[model samples]
Target: MLKGGCRLNGKKRCLLPLLLAGVLFSCTVTFSAAKKIPTILVCPKTLDNSFWGNVRAGAMTAGKEYGASVIWKGPTVETDIAGQLAIMEDFVNKRVDAIALAATDVKALYAPVKKALNAKIPVVSFDSGLDPDPTLCLIATDNYKGAFEAGEALARLIGQKGKIACIPLISGASTSILREKGFNAAIARYPGIRLVAVQYSESDVAKGMAVAENILTANPDLDGIFAANEPGAMGAAQAVKARGLSGKVKLVAFDASPMEIEMLQNGTIQALIVQNPYNMGYLAVKTCIEALNGKKVPKRIDTGVAVVTMDNFYEPKIQQLLYPAGNSGK
Candidate 1:
């Protein structure tokens, strides 16, 4: 027996064959309709750091778990707003199932993100966010609270009285703006502490080092420093160490990269304000997939942060937070 033909629709087909009397039989048996595996595009601020690397890992892990094809792409530097915008727009035109973006600039990315929304593509903004957010959901750390905690930690290390300077990531980024404000707000609490100089690193390590060196030179008696991101932190640490002011000028930095961790162990960086980048990346893709599946998704998801210091660095939970493998999609 044989069927005339098989109709291929939005379903999967399995063929069962039978042979008898030198005759062959074929039948198209359909299982429940197969769902299309979605292709999700994940764009972080930059493709050049361990933070974004962790995010990529988390996103890929989610894609594997949820039957999605994940495409990771971003600009080479975090300051390349135009580059990131072009990338997003290209993906939108390609009609990828969904887009997970960690915008380079808060306002600059709104147009393309809005365009994606208009095209019926779900957008999930993570890390740095979009202003007038048109995305389906935002997954990020509480940058303000983390920076405030960093300020408080620096204040305590300097014994609540000293000249301190700040090196924020960049001026236009939401993360930069919030962290700078939060640190300033915390510093305002104590009349004895004076925030002497503030500079923008533009998320460049050499620039961060140069900025810190200038600040230290201007205020020879500078007591402490707060660096708001990884590049800034690394640069500040190098500056502090080069001047042989390792433990003298207390430094509290954000994100614990390998260099920062080495600095922490050697008394170059006093504390690290760490975010769950892995969790952030994982949740972003998970949310995008959910939206594509016609499932309800939350408007906001806080991946949270931790203030890490020598006193609690070895704790199991903190260790897991610092290492990506210990806490992927958990």
Candidate 2:
């Protein structure tokens, strides 16, 4: 029915329809403008840990630097391959300008990555990757080398004459595989150091602790232990503390966590294999943006790693790697 001007039963002619039309037109213009600016999606292993938090921050910082809209999200934890794959598929369908992925599983993610590439989306793998393809551009720590250093550090700390064990993050994780290889290589050099046991933590803290406890029980004379990643390290540290083996166990671990830092201060772990996760995040986004802008980017970027012992813990460089953006809230 008709009313005053263009509305029915309204005192002031119900301008609602005209107002909505104006708003719709304005929204369309804004959206069209937004589409012109490139959109990048940065998907990490998870958002729960301090490691991934810094990754997220560095990625957003680069996004702001490059004037690109960045969407940072992933599974709740590192083990959720299906969740990560779904996000990739969604981004592919949306035709995102590019994607930076820290793959959940090495081989499982290869197909999804190829799918994104086929859909004309540039993909950059950071922190970890699918395969040994430098063409995809991997921004990550030199895991094998770093792990070898950790192994040597541990051997020296233990005087290379006792049984030791390794608690890896997971079996199929590329980082885990490389670190394991490097560790084996290092251990071979120390004949006096016997490899009594090796366990997989499935990237779970509790499992890491349980595995540590079991290994310690099975070999009470165990001299040293290496934890492959943050969670396993934390779990191993816990197990050592629980058994009152803190200083006696000669623990060496990878990555940095609040608990790990506390352990370092308290003498739970003799050394930490620290990686530059923040740089990995920043550079991944930067590379993706550059590619979108038609700039050629390198396919392999080692973000680098270092051994953080008490001797070098307070140094400026180690401080930056230990605490990126001066925030270690985890």
Candidate 3:
């Protein structure tokens, strides 16, 4: 007597239906074991911020739709270049099917990115990118243009003539560099505007606040400020609010984090240069999947940016930008 009430001692006496059922079960198990879902690794500069959280949401949404496993990982802080590189190397060693990276350091990421490419893994960059652009596709906002628009807006808020300062996220980062340049170029257009100081926040709120405080202390006559990223914006807004200069010192910052939006509403931040991080993450994953499927993807995809102010905050399009359905605009 065997498990299905079939005697195995004499094979010819066994029930044909039971034997066929057992064979079918074994075949089904084997087939199920053979199929494997593709895995995609999405690495942002840091994982602690709401901006990155929104990006993660978008990436995960795309992963679910495309039937690929999404692994979201990154350093706790944006300045941890070594940590990011290590994470990338480990994932490459694990042989993930694809990688979407918002690299912390432009030059340091090339080696691991190159290795992943050599191993036939597709790498897509988002938010920030590598120096030489080794990734198959770059899905991100046009940082330069966004910053330029922010500068123009800030200048307008200050009546186009006043002392200003800049708080950029990371000095050596590609996005930071481009943003700073664009901001300076825009400021250059208005000869009456004077850039009084510049500082690097490393995308840390406290650091941004400290720098903003110092800039304010050094130049009491400063009329406007531009903080290049979300954390920077929060810090600058706090500094301005604390100094009782909410309206006195005009502030235009980047990214529409909840805190930033609140500041904008309260007039602490006059305007926000909003980037579609959700789109960046979504497109990064989508592009990676396309590349893995042997389809050609564009070398670059601009997720686009928008400037938001109190005047048009309630508009339907701005509301959509601020609160994308699945994303809380974190």
Candidate 4:
């Protein structure tokens, strides 16, 4: 009764029994595939800032939803490209299913990223993208556009004709460089606006405050300031408030930190260009799943951005998108 030599239930199996056995085997394979859980390694640039924290939240949400084992790790402070690379190397050695990274140094990450690729590991770049790599996919905000929006908002707040200073976190960071370029381009559209000075804060709030104090001391008449990130913005706001020039100097900053939002609500900061960090994280996880499943995905996906001010701060989508779940909606 058996098609081959094997017998089922102590007797030679007929063609019908063989077909039923094949069906059962196929069902077993399907069940095994469905029960398999994917493991993901998420490495943000740093957890010091709320931006990366939001990214971690999104990744965790995805992990929970998709039955994935997610390991979220990063540096305590940014600018530690070496530390990030070392972590990535360890993750690769562990043979994770995939890696999602927010690269601190675009060029410095080349070696480690390539190392992961050579080991047949998929890497997805989120938040901050690395230079074009054939083996990596990028999910991020369009930095240039976001910065341009901040510049336009600043120009409007300062009445188009004013002196503004740019306090960027890092001079060589690719995202910061693009944001500066966009900010400069936007200001170029308005002939009355002039960029007085561009200073590097090295991603330190105290350093940003010190630089802002020195700049304000030198140019007391300056009417506008554009801080490339949240720390610099908060530091500048503190400096302005300390000097009792809160309403006099218009502040337009990047990212919507709780402090920055409070400043906006309190009339200290005029506007902030907020990036969708949650979306960045969600998309990064989705992309990794797709890639691992042998599905095609884009090399770069823009998470888009928004400008947050006092007027629309309470909108539902804005609240959910910015604050996510479990975060104090402060």
Candidate 5:
């Protein structure tokens, strides 16, 4: 009986070893088959502007929702094309799953974007798009439409036919170029309205203010002004105010900075064409994730636009998207 008992104990020990081996093999297979979440790199023009901050928030939201890591990095200034290119290259070298960029120079970014594509890393352009490569998906506002609306608003404010000057941040940047084209096209509809001058400020607030000052001095009869972005608009408004012509000259600007919104409320500025920057950031990341999953995303996604004035500026929907709880002035 004792011998028989020892044999049964030995058999139980053998079975235990088999069970442990089976469990270890199953765990290894499970880990190997687990899905790997892709990492997304977001390279904005700059983080100093509130507009880009909204974009970063949007990208973060998408990153959280999709279980992906997001790296938001960019130059402190807008004109840092070389800095932007370096960031793109870094992402490519790290073998990031994807990159979303707001190109400082559309033509200058072609080589870098192409290199990313060659490495099988997908590239998406947000805010400012690349013109060279047809494969890059672009997520941005319909700048022309938004700028046209702004021009119409300015024309209405001016009432009589007069000369309007435009101070754009950058001459050749895709967004500014589109805005200039749209503004010119719309202003052309009104026979009395004329674009007197177009100046490039290099996206510098101080330079924009100085340029506006010079233009105002050169053409005191300038009845209206359009700024392609928030900083440009604010700087131009300051120049107009310094000359004691705030309400006298109609100002139509882009981007709804807190100061800009306040100006709109106080009647300092007539109108603002606000871009859905948050949506642009969010959609850029979402599209990238979709692409990674082999899902088709549209090459050009218009994140949409809004025209804000004192009347409906405080609307709940716009406030929730633009100002959110902690970010709002009030």
Candidate 6:
């Protein structure tokens, strides 16, 4: 009988080293399978709105395509800067393989994003971005250009000469900041167009409507209105409808929500400056994976935009961009 390594048996002796080898092989296979899939944490600015839901869908799609795992979470509202920062810190603490973030406040989120980068986790920013460029990629629409187009569209609707109001979703949001500058720049191009009032909605739906109402009341002779985001557009549409000024005072807004689409269909909204949010979300995750794989990713990736109205909203080509989730025929 082999004292330590063998079982004394009448016939087939079992060796301890052979049994140990089999156990080691099984563990090696299990560990390798688990390590094959990289887990990512995606934190958008807000998940309550449909816009962010589309972003989440895109990220999830990318995750499936790349054989990666994703954990999607964010603040319930876009203005919750502290909450967003806390989420980022928590993801960092969890040691996620990568992170995709949409910053609620650029400067406020900078420190946490930087901390994740310093901790050697790759980060990507989509939609609104973080300052200091801690992200491997910044995937976003050309907000300034889109807003300028919206301004020009409004200017045309008002004969390029009238007192107009600018309603922005959030005063501190990076997208809002760019859109404001763009709208202002476009309005200045025409000597006749005057940007009279600028009121903030703080990214709240009700506040958007209330602010719009106040702007209209304060300027009874206002000719046109430009809403800089989905909520702003929605509120502005409601305000315009409630005042019975639908066709009289043109409303040009950014982003296309179901409500905004219905507004366009009914002539409450004249024009919509739309962005490829799905593309932004998908590319952001793709870039993060690239960075994690030791591949070079571009610092800036621009998702394109389009201006949609009732006249062109149903075009087959446009539907793909506006409804990437296979709603083209609907």
- Output the number of the TM-score-best candidate: 5
Which ten-residue region of model 3 has the weakest summed lDDT? 321-330
Off by over 4 Å in 6: 1-31, 328-330
| Residue range 170-203, candidate 6, lDDT tens digits | 7678888889999998989889988889999777
lDDT of 5 by residue, 204-309 (tens): 7788788899899989899999998988988888898888898998899999878888888777788888888888888999999998888988888998888877
What's the lDDT for residue 275 in model 6? 87
The all-Cα superposition gives candidate 1 an RMSD in Å to the true structure of 6.7
* Candidate 1 wrongly placed segments (more than 4 Å): 1-35, 326-330
Q: TM-score for model 3? A: 0.90
Candidate lDDT (C-alpha), each: 0.90, 0.87, 0.91, 0.85, 0.85, 0.86
62-93: candidate 3 lDDT, tens digit per residue: 99999899999999999999999999999999
Ranking by TM-score: 5, 6, 3, 1, 4, 2
Q: State how far residue 249 of model 4 sits from its true place (Å).
A: 0.8
lDDT per residue for candidate 2 within 1-330, as digits (tens), equals 563465455735576778889999999999988677789989988877778887888898998998889999898877898999899889888999899998888988888788888887889999888865433589999999999998899999999888999998877788889999999899889889999999998788898999999999999999999999988999899999999999999999998877788899899998999888878889999999888878888878999989998888888878878887675433
Q: Give the poorly placed runs of model 5, Cα more than 4 Å off.
A: 1-35, 326-330
lDDT of 6: 0.86
The true-versus-predicted C-alpha distance at residue 308 of model 5, in Å, is 1.2
lDDT of 1 by residue, 243-265 (tens): 99999999999998878888998
Candidate 2's displacement at residue 210, Å, is: 1.0
TM-score of 2: 0.87
Q: Which segments of candidate 2 are over 4 A away from where they belong?
A: 1-35, 132-135, 327-330
- Tell me, by lDDT, which candidate is best: 3
Worst window of 10 by summed lDDT in candidate 2: 3-12
Cα shift from native, residue 51, model 4 (Å) = 1.5
